[model samples]
Target: MLRFVSFTLAIVAMCNGQIAVERDPVCGTRNGFYGIEGNCDAYVECRDYRSREMQCPDGLHFDPAVAWPNYPCGYPMEVDCAGRGIAQPAQPSAECPHLYGFFPSPKATADECGYYRMCVDGVAVEMACPPGLAFNPSNARCDWPDTVSTCNAAAFLGFTCPPPPVNEIGELIEGPVNYKYEGNCFAFFSCEEGRARLLSCDAGYGFDPISGRCVDGDIIKC
Candidate 1:
């Protein structure tokens, strides 16, 4: 059976800001993944009494907590580096800050929050969020613009969620609400948690505000 461990060697050196690490004969006793000291992106794999140094891909970190048979490298956002630092330098491009990550498009206008780029292995691929949404860097996913601090939700959405109904004590009563986008018959807004989210219907359908559902385009003239 394989196990995870942190093995350190007495020999160490620092050359040009890179940590030169040497490992002890850990595999001589057992096979497992071993973490290097002070380096979150590097590890030592011991197998059949042989040891090999490995580095996680750019934008990823080695996670020894993961069990064997599963890749130990994971995205930086999901892995906790604790006190360990990343040793590998980043390879960036005009569109990619790192070899792998989601980034906002450089050409996007101040009011345009829908465009983004997905970087993989130093290559960038353009992507677009659904209408009425924006790219959120915090979570690296498309989310309501109102919740994205970098985006101006009111300016991009062109509408705001109305104040919820009030109760007898003047407290707000929260409930889901839907509204039509004035000029676009196929698109509409769904309000939840005081945020207005833009949604769309299928190509052959239109949003019906009265019924609060999508209907055949033939039944509702734009």
Candidate 2:
């Protein structure tokens, strides 16, 4: 698991840096994406390489070292650098499902069969599949999906695989209020008062009116 010492430290390290040089497939936007791209919520400004402008919405200097490259999937596997061999960040453990992660497309074709392909920055990398599973490009398996809701495949080594659309969310820096005590943190999530059946909470923390809670693996935030 990737652990940050403090939320303030995390903010100092992550927010308001340039978006990964690559483009975000969803909105076809580069330099940033959604609410995160260059928001400066963490009190920093990321310089847009194209515009060369330095602006931090939250009022902090951009830290080049902490910038998370913008990728299509929330947690993309590949790292993109302009003519640079940027090492990829490690995938987060399953205990915390919201961190960035990686996955493969499908097995390659017969000609390319036996080839294992991992999706990096939404692009497929051709390589030999690990022992056991034969490459089946048609299936497009991102890591092996452990569909059993109760199971934590990512937590166990060698038995699980990365979930597709490698999604990510910031870690829980604060505790919750208003909700009554629940057995665990994951269970506290339930639908808001008047909302439809959306998602349930894990235990200690219910959904954030702002960052939305995880409901059936779908992220529904305010």
Candidate 3:
């Protein structure tokens, strides 16, 4: 019986490793993307084995999860890019507010988050929160540092700037680096100058800084 149990465990381990490798999405792994014919708006880059930048039409966001054989950039957001196309500058960032005609979130409550995606000159960009502050999603608005008094941090854009650590003498610690946390895999710490600050991952994910992938902490070995 013990021998059988050990064999089962080994099989499970092998399956886990296989799934991890096969599920690991690569930037250019999708053949459907390459097959996308004609000229298109090249967007985010997948700097891996595919060895090239990815592209989609002007309004679509590059969702790596939806790679190859689908839309070049996966899915598309409902932005009025067709109505107001912002001329692409020489360089572009994926989180482009200007990609679509920016308008106030029609569904926003009176007490809205500070940096909600809004139309700036017909572009949708998330405006910055106050200097010493960050956006809090619980209230769907910006709040004081003390406003978030519990672990309900998943719904906010946390401020990453932290004061230097006083415990250690002023020895330069290499940083401005991001690290995954055992507590919450989706959230990560952006550490710089000895201070590590938390930044929330995208909705429905914990971050794995080692792989630079958003993952669920509940499953990762940490």
Candidate 4:
């Protein structure tokens, strides 16, 4: 359960004389899939107003550092700087689902399986359900063993051998997930002792997918 202190500091335009950055509502065009990357209602932009030529290296994405200098905005996983300048495959690189917190791909959509990834801080880590448990996408949380309508044993034997989930709107949960509650704070629903349990976010907080934490509801992805 990662949380952030209340965001009271205004988003001032901090400029280093060479690069000034701020979070903007303008969408970022990364990986082929578009709409909005992760829960980021705004993208970080560092530019030289005179020419807008400033940019982060190819391997790195812009980070607003809203949390502080500790959490640099970008991919949670390490980037191979050496791979820069190489012709990338036409397809988008495999990446964590920035939309849902910072979930990596292959589990972003959250299928019949009972496991997915949760972005704690800026790193994407795998979360599993309890023993004899699998997540029911239709219910939006963990459920009894073999309860999901799409649990394909042949397709998955190790992913959910025993465990967790992701969150979405009215769509199925697929796994344990943390989501915004009624346009307010964050609430994560999971299975405790074979029953569903909903955990509310701390006061004055909401789930922000871009940063992958419970922050002020000023920007709600849900």
Candidate 5:
């Protein structure tokens, strides 16, 4: 009986290992292999393979549990599929957004997580997000940054002229540099003497130093 019990445990261990190898999404190693952390869903998380802590793949890393495919770079958001900004069931006829206009094949099963498809742009490559994420037509892709907060950051564009140096004139202060938080563009500037300041607008349109060039003080328009 003890011999039989030992054999059963061995079989179970073998099966689990096999599944881990086959289920590995990134690199499929042969029978005696383990996995490491990767952006792709199929990869197993092996912390130390042979003494070295596995670094994140070239373009991938472990994502926070808060977001699916947690390492956020640019994955389509759910709203791209359904017109409404609500989560919808993943269906067979589901169409994905294109990079320029091309997209990957439909998911075989909802469990697949994400898809890898062609980019419509001339890049001629395939991109992917975690399963369930989709491109947003309103913003163009799942990975597009949120614009609302970006737009709000325009408030940061206040005023600061002298460009520092205690009180030096003719310093040829550098023109405003545009810095964006999300989609919004705020001004960033450096003085010729090495001081910096922020530029902003009050009423109508116009920002300090270089006033009223672009409306609404936006560094990036839309």
Candidate 6:
């Protein structure tokens, strides 16, 4: 767990070896933001020889590359906290792994791939992806389950994509293809990169395997 301390207080606390803060060219020599030693989420603001410690918001880190007065902080993924390795301790909740970010739902099941949790200032809010899509934690967005490792596309949709067609030489044909999802008139399987992704037709429409497209639901037999 990381701790934040003002520049002055840090010097005093260093003796205990509990928290190590950077001590360098004193602040107030220049009007700008300076990175705190060993702390990625904290910086010192200098104005007219006056200094005040500042901290980036939750889930963000100080970006020395950014200039002053323009908000020199950014998301941890975007900022490179190389030497300055320390960060604020995570404030986790039952539904939130961090104070601000998207996380997989704790209650998600094999069939419930669309559920996710959004954390804002330590508060957790449950969210769900639209039908035919699954919550992807890698990129923090809703995507096809086949492309998301955590969600097994075949198990979730109870369908598997068949092997791709091959030519006379037995070379795998590479292209997009669709297949009907058995027992579900509204859904189908879209195959890409040898993975099966479950897709759905719009309201009042059903998948037509013969035509390989969605058609009017009234004319399609379930």
Q: Output the number of the TM-score-best candidate.
A: 1
Global CA lDDT of candidate 6, please? Answer: 0.79
Model 4: residues with Cα > 4 Å off, grouped in runs: 1-93, 102-112, 120-122, 138-140, 152-222
Count clashing pairs, candidate 4. Answer: 13
- Per-model TM-score on C-alpha atoms: 0.66, 0.18, 0.24, 0.23, 0.18, 0.59
Error of 2 at 14 (Å): 32
User: Lowest lDDT 10-mer window, candidate 3?
Assistant: 78-87
Query: Which has the better lDDT: candidate 1, or candidate 4?
Result: 1
Tens digits of per-residue lDDT for model 4 on 1-222? Answer: 122222222223233232334433242322111111332222343222211222332223434433322333344233222323332112222333232232322452324365756544334567766533565545435565345566653243222222333346554346343332233347643343233443455777776745546777676655
TM-score of 4: 0.23
| TM-score for candidate 2 | 0.18
Task: Give me the overall lDDT of model 2.
Answer: 0.32
**Which model, 3 or 6, shows the larger TM-score?**
6
Compared with the true structure, what per-residue lDDT tens digits does model 5 show for residues 108-187? 12333233455432233545553224333344343311222222111222223343333265554344443222223343
Write model 6 residue lDDT over 1-222, tens digit each, in one string: 235446657777777675743444566455689888889989988775467899987777899888777888886557867778789987776656777777788777767788898788778888998766888888778898877878867777677777887889999877868899877899888887778777789999999999889999998988
Superior candidate under TM-score, 2 versus 6: 6
Q: State the TM-score for model 3.
A: 0.24
- lDDT by residue (7-52, candidate 2, tens digit) is 5566765677623364224332334422334332222222342322
Colliding pairs, model 1: none
Off by over 4 Å in 6: 1-33, 46-51, 65-70, 80-83, 93-95, 130-133, 136-144, 167-171, 179-189, 198-222
- Preferred candidate (lDDT higher): 3 or 6: 6
Q: Give the TM-score comparing model 1 with the true structure, all chains together.
A: 0.66
Question: lDDT: which is higher, 3 or 5?
Answer: 3
lDDT of 3 by residue, 84-170 (tens): 333234233344434443323433333333344544334555565553234544543445433534322333334344454343777
Local lDDT at 71 for model 6: 87
- Indicate the worst ten consecutive residues by lDDT in candidate 6: 20-29
